[model samples]
Structure formats: C-alpha cells, structure tokens
Target: MIYDGDEVEQELCVDLYWSFRSPYSYLALHHVRALAKAYALRWNVKVVYPLAIRTPDFFKRMDHMWRPYLLIDTQRIAESLGMPFRRPVPDPIVQDPRTLLISLEQPHIHRLTRLGAEAMLRGRALELVDAVGTMLWDGSVDGWNQGDHLARAVAAAGLDLQDMETAIARDPQARDRLIETNEAELRAAGHWGVPTFVFRGEPFFGQDRVELLLWRLRQHGLQARSN
Candidate 1:
C-alpha cells in the first residue's frame, strides 16, 4: 500500500456522493474503489447526510412504497450479488416507527459523518466506509457503533480512528462546514441521493448505473493498468 516515488497519472474524476445509512451506498462502495484502482481516474468522494434526516418534508411525504420497496430490492440485489444482507440493528436514523419522523438525536450518524470527512482528508474515506458500512448493513457485527468496532475498521483501512476522532474534535465547525459543502455540491451535481456518481458534470445516479459509468469511462479511453 505504500506509494513509491513515481508519480501516478490521473485522468477522469468521479465525484461520488454517498450516505452512511444507505444500503445502496454500502453495495456500491467497493465497486467505486475498484473502478478507481482499475483505471487512471481520480475517485473523489462527497459524503452527505441521508435524505431521511436532510429533508424532513420529503421524508414525511415520500411514497408509501419507498421504504418497503427499498428493503425488498436491496435484499434482492444483495442476493444477486451474493452479499450478506440484513436490516441494521438500531438503524442509523432513530425514528418513530409510526410517523417515520427522524429524531433530533443522531450521535452515531453524526460521528460517522464527521469521521467520514476525516477519512477523506486522509484520502481513505471510500475504503473506510466500504469496510465499516458493510459490517453494519451485512449484519456481520452487532452494535457497530459501540466498543472498538469502528476503531478496528479504521485501522484496517490504514488509519488511526483515535487520531481521526481527535482531529475532528479539534475543529467541529470545520467538519460541519465540509459536510455542508458536500451537500451543496451533491445538489449542484443534479442528484440528491446516495451512490450518485458525477463524472465531468454528468450524473449517473444509483448502484445499477455502475455499468453505464464504465461505458462512459471507456468512451473516454479508460483502460486497465498494466501489471
């Protein structure tokens, strides 16, 4: 994982907007990492707050079929991809089940978003999120937000979680502003959802559009790196 003195060539830049609480984002993360590594592309990430918390009005008026269909579709997609799938324990957003109204308390998610920004600063956000989000979404770990789970995941991604937490604590306002900026960029990119990939101002939204992105990348002369 160490980079030598030789400078790496960069070509396309993918502005990836994702959410920690999104199952689709969980599923698409590894692919994004692979896409970046497989070709000469600058894989930039913009982590944002989930729609449930970001837009309360829309969350309240969302189509009734949205949640149920999302659950069903995620399960189906997980099965097709041979990935472990399960509903998160104490879901990321603590909401009233009846009204689906998001709660004001979001200790876990706020920490995640803040640390996600830290990871990005360290140039490892995609890898860190891919590792930790899968644990939460795939049911591999319980109480993902508790104990040393997150720390271990960060370490595995070649970062110190304690250091990241420390840095974030040092400037809460800066991290908050970065997240706000990311949300604004996501909206400006013509998409407000997780897993939206924007390449040179063109937006490809959704986990299923990865192939489409690849096609466009190929059109721009993307090629596999010589081993």
Candidate 2:
C-alpha cells in the first residue's frame, strides 16, 4: 500500500507519548524518525513530564534490584541497536541517590518539555528531540542546555529557539496544561510509558515493541518508498 497524503480516508496517524528524561526515548529516536519518514502520516508527539517529577514516590516502593537491572538490560539493548549509551549529564532529576528524594528545582526538564511542545507546534518535533537528546544522552557535549547548544539544536530543526521561548513564555499555562493533558491521555490509553506508540487507539509500549508497531502499520497499508 502506497500512502499518499491525498486521501483523507487513507490517513494514518500515530500518537507518540514521550519524555525528555527517558534514556529509552533517546535510544528510540532513530526508529521514530524512520517511522515518520517512511510513511505518510501525522506524527502527533504528545510530550509528558518525566515520571520523576509527576510521581515523586514512583521509585520509593520499587524492588531494590530494579535500577541496576534496568541499567544492565538497557545497556544491552543500546548495544544491540548500535546506539551510544550513557546517563544524561547532571541527570534530569535533582534527587539524592542515597535517599532518592527528588528536589523541586528542576529547571531543565520543564524548559525542555515546553520547548518540545513548541517544536511539535512547528512540525519539526522529531528532529528537535533527536538532536537535543543526542547531545544530552551522549558524552560529546558539555552543558547540554547551555549557551549555543539549544540554539544549535533548534536551528538544526529549522526553528528559532528565541522565538519559541517567547511564544511559550507568553502562555506558560497552556504548555503546562498540555503536558498534564498528555499524561491524562496516556492513562486513558492504558499505559504510562515513554516511547509508547499509539495507532488507531491501540497502545504499543516500549522501544522493543517498535517492530510490532511497524507490523501494525503494514496492516494499515503504510507506504514504503520505492527509491
């Protein structure tokens, strides 16, 4: 099935519930990019605040083995995908590792989320996320949010950072509400995980489920490029 944007009845859309602080999201960007570029569809990225902020006690009741196992498993997944794997510099949370008490001074996360919303509005969200997430997740760049890093990122996405900031500042409540609304919608979708892809109201959670998503897309007649 060749997907051309001409037919309204043929439109295929996917809602991507994503987070800035998720390492999986950073790793999943390439696959998302492929899906967006390979098929004719509206990629509706519904950005959400990281779980660390939304639910501070989320990790409090977890089994002691969760974090270490997650790191080991995620590292293997990154290696399998040939992606660079590293924790974000300065980390996204202001949590004390020993006590796991998250601080409220998360200056970066909120700004990034708002910028993501702005990027989505500009129709270059995946580009912005891929560019910025790479810088933050990899060791190549220092101070990922400092100086020209953000400018360079938005520029790569063909967007103006100052312009986006100005717009977001004008109505900060709307951006916050958007994140809140995405979280609600994610709950309604029956999962609260990053890198979840929703197609026709069906939820495919995890970066591992990307192949399943592509299979579903095929069933929906998603087009493949001949060249």
Provide the RMSD of all predictions against the true structure, rounded to 1 decimal.
4.6, 2.6
What TM-score against the true fold does each predicted structure earn? Answer: 0.92, 0.91
Per-residue accuracy of model 1 over 157-226 as CA lDDT, tens digit each: 8889888899999998898899899999988989898889998788999999999999977766665866
lDDT for model 1? 0.82
lDDT agreement with native, every candidate: 0.82, 0.82
Regions more than 4 Å wrong, model 2: 1-9
Model 2 per-residue lDDT at 67:
86
- Expressed as tens digits, the lDDT of each residue in 104-213 for candidate 2 is 78888889999988887778777778887787776676777777977887788788989999999999898888789989999899898898889878999998889998
The TM-score measured for candidate 1 stands at 0.92
Q: Roughly what TM-score does model 2 have, to 2 decimal places?
A: 0.91
